[model samples]
Target: MILITGAAGYIGSITSYHFLKNNYKVIGIDNISTGNARALEVLNKFDNFKFYEGNFGNLELLEQIVTNNKIDFVVHFAANTSVFESTQNPLKYHDNNVSNMINLLKICEKYDINNFIFSSSAATYGEPKTNELITEDTPKNPINPYGLTKLIGEYILNDLSNAKKEFNFIALRYFNVAGASLIAPLGQFSKSSLLIKIAAECAANKRDKMYLYGNDYNTPDGTCVRDYIHVDDLAIAHIEALKYLKNQKTSQAFNVGYSKGTSVKEVIDIMKKISGNDFKVEMADRRTGDPSSLVASNKKITSLTDWKYSNDNLELICKSAYEWELKI
Candidate 1:
């Protein structure tokens, strides 16, 4: 059985569905703090899906779960993930992202759950020193508490792997993850500060206008550039990570992205074109801890694993997100 933490969140829920469709029994745990109940309702439709509404950090609850189920692999996606919010309440980020991760690691070690797939972020790289694409070899110098906590979690994993050769993990440092699931009616259900989500909200008339944070960056369009990956593509990466672990490959980190950069203005323009909405876009000051440009060098993951991109188009991604936004 596969254990999925934060399975009620956007990427987690979709990933759970993929695993369930593959005929794998899935055990999901969530705190519902920022998770969506609608996601749980959808997952519950699957006969092989068993869910518990609680924090993964709860050692007693975790013990109950591990003792009951024979968990083979763990896909961890639970954490506080806002760069802006991380800056505001650093303690919260450290406690939830760092402390809770440590607690979960302890449970994994005790339960002999050797294979782990971590939901890392590009934020761990902080601001890139150049405009070049980031690779797994890039220096990790996080600028925010959220990034630092994730970095710390990676370090802990590395340490654990070193101490116990039987323990292995793959950390996928995700870029901007967007889009909704194509197979189901599922999508991001929580309120978000992500550019695409906000733009979709405006396109769906859920919001009055969308804010363009930081338009004076050192990019071609003077806006922050991000490599947006479809959520299903990311979910596929997790499956590939599991395959790598099953093959007993060496533990390592891989960058997950399209290796193409899209500026904030470009994304807004695409959303406007796809949704046919002349949405109001107000220019705003740069948010804290946002990089000017962050594109990925996906050569490592593609060359090493059978991971292939299915939805790499920006227009299709925006349209999928807009369609889901209209439904929600």
Candidate 2:
């Protein structure tokens, strides 16, 4: 069985479904913090699935699951992701992102489970000025607590692997993870993520205005550019990564993205067209630690396994998000 932390979260929930469909038994853990209970309701439909409502940081709860479930591998996806929030409370990021990750590593050690996968972020590399694409080896100079903490978490996982020598891990450094779950029946919810939520708000008329976080970025439109990979593609990557690790493929880290970018205003404009609502838009000062552009070099992931992206350019991404907004 595979143990998935943060299983009620956007990416983790989708990954759970993929594993279930691929005929793997999955045990999921979430504290209901930053997780949608509705997502868990949809996931419970599978017979091969078991859900544990608990935090991975709680060693007692985590130990119980690891002992009772016979967990064969772990795919960790729990962390504070907001750049703004992390800046405000560095302690929250450290306790959850860094401390919880180390605790998970320790649990793996105690449980004798050697294989693991992680949901890392492009935030691991802060504000790229000129690199059109970021590779796994890109120089990391995280400018915020959130980014620095994720980078540190990656190092901890890698260090654990080196120290154990028998344990193997695959850390997927994800760019912006967006889009609804493409498979029928499990659509995106309002709480799925930022981009999707923004489109949903515009679609629902809940938001009369949308704020573009920054407009002074050094890009064509002076807005932040991000890779914005669809959630389904990311789920597929996780399954493939699991299989690759099962086959003992030894790569430790790989960037997961389309290597394409969509600007901030460009996304809002697309949403406006799709939702038929010209919501107010404001260009504000640059958000702290936000990179001008963060596109991943996805070649390593593709070459290593059969993983390939299959959805949503800028306009399409926004359109699908709007559609899901109406549906969910």
TM-score of candidate 2 against the unseen true structure? 0.96
Give the per-residue lDDT of model 2 (tens digit) for 86-110: 9989999999998888888888999
Question: lDDT of each prediction vs. the true structure?
Answer: 0.93, 0.82
Q: Go through the candidates in order and give the clash count of each.
A: 0, 0
Candidate 1, residue 86: the lDDT equals 95
lDDT at residue 232 of model 2 (Cα atoms):
85
Per-model TM-score, in order, reads 0.99, 0.96
Number of the top lDDT candidate: 1
lDDT of candidate 1 over 175-210, digit per residue (tens) = 999999998667899999888988999999999998
Q: Which stretches of candidate 2 lie over 4 Å from their true place?
A: 187-193, 249-251
Candidate 1 lDDT for residue 28: 99
